[model samples]
Target: MTESQDLDLTPRDADDVSVGRKRLRNWLIMGTFTAVIGFVLFQALTSAAQFYYNVDEAVARRGELEDSTFRIQGTVTSEQAPDANGALIFTIAYGGVDTAVRHVGAEPSDLFEIGIPVVSEGHWEGDVFQSRQLLVKHSESYEAENPDRVEYDLDDTPGYVPDNTVE
Candidate 1:
């Protein structure tokens, strides 16, 4: 008869009950960290988003024009004349005041006549935005993209060549 005596298995460790509390603390820490990271990522994405603003809108919101890219839409204001290189000189008035824009490149589109809107890309330097590219804003209309409408006249009839043809 091996001794089969009672072993008092009571109060093994008083802090053993704290496991549940520790888990709750861990969960709270993890959750708070996740929430903070998620919020920061959302704000960065929002701030880096593309912004399309008119000249007036840009002028009114100079604070919004920090070191961020922007697409400003406005009519190319007529100037005294073109520059020496034939690049058009004009002012893009966003709001009541106009800032000079020097477009030293190809001529504006045929439709880029005065009073027609054009979109320019640039960052604001002070109260002025130095445009790097100009794009004419087209009206809301669609045209069929048939081959006939294409400007190029190319031979699309594929005359197949063997793999050995290109040496």
Candidate 2:
């Protein structure tokens, strides 16, 4: 009787094998789906990251930057008058190297004059950096205007106002 009881316990039914296979298949499906989702997320986040380079570095790495978005920091070395289509072409230089830039959107800010530092974000095309966005960096110093030096025109109607109030 003990032997008979042992045999009954040792033998597994077909139902048990079927249940085990189903559980393993379900777990494999879940794991595969999770891995695929994680891979896609990683790819998207890495592609969206933008790296910045100086003018000299950009010129040196022009081959790698082609068709890729990047940020460049430099000074406006030269500028050409706007074309009939309002496209502004200019050159920015840093570390003694220059990169040609073309902007087709709105004109640069008043502070975007020559020799001023600028950070441009765009992609590198053939022999040029096509920038869609331009940022001008200015000094952080602030100076208040003198209130004592007020100018009034005698020959014209006087409606002038000073910037600061004198104590």
TM-score attained by model 1: 0.45
Report the lDDT tens digits of candidate 2 across residue range 1-167. Answer: 67766565543655887889989999999999999999998987875454467788888898876788888887776678877878788877776667788887666789887666787888888878898888886767665777886553322211111221111
On a 0 to 100 scale, what is the lDDT of residue 128 in model 2?
83
Clashing pairs in 1: 55-94, 56-94, 56-95
TM-scores, all models, native as reference = 0.45, 0.54
Error of 2 at 122 (Å): 1.1
Model 2 segments more than 4 A misplaced = 1-51, 141-167
Per-residue CA lDDT of model 1 for 51-82, tens digit only, reads 46877677777786685777777655544477
Highest TM-score model number: 2
lDDT against the true structure, each candidate: 0.62, 0.72
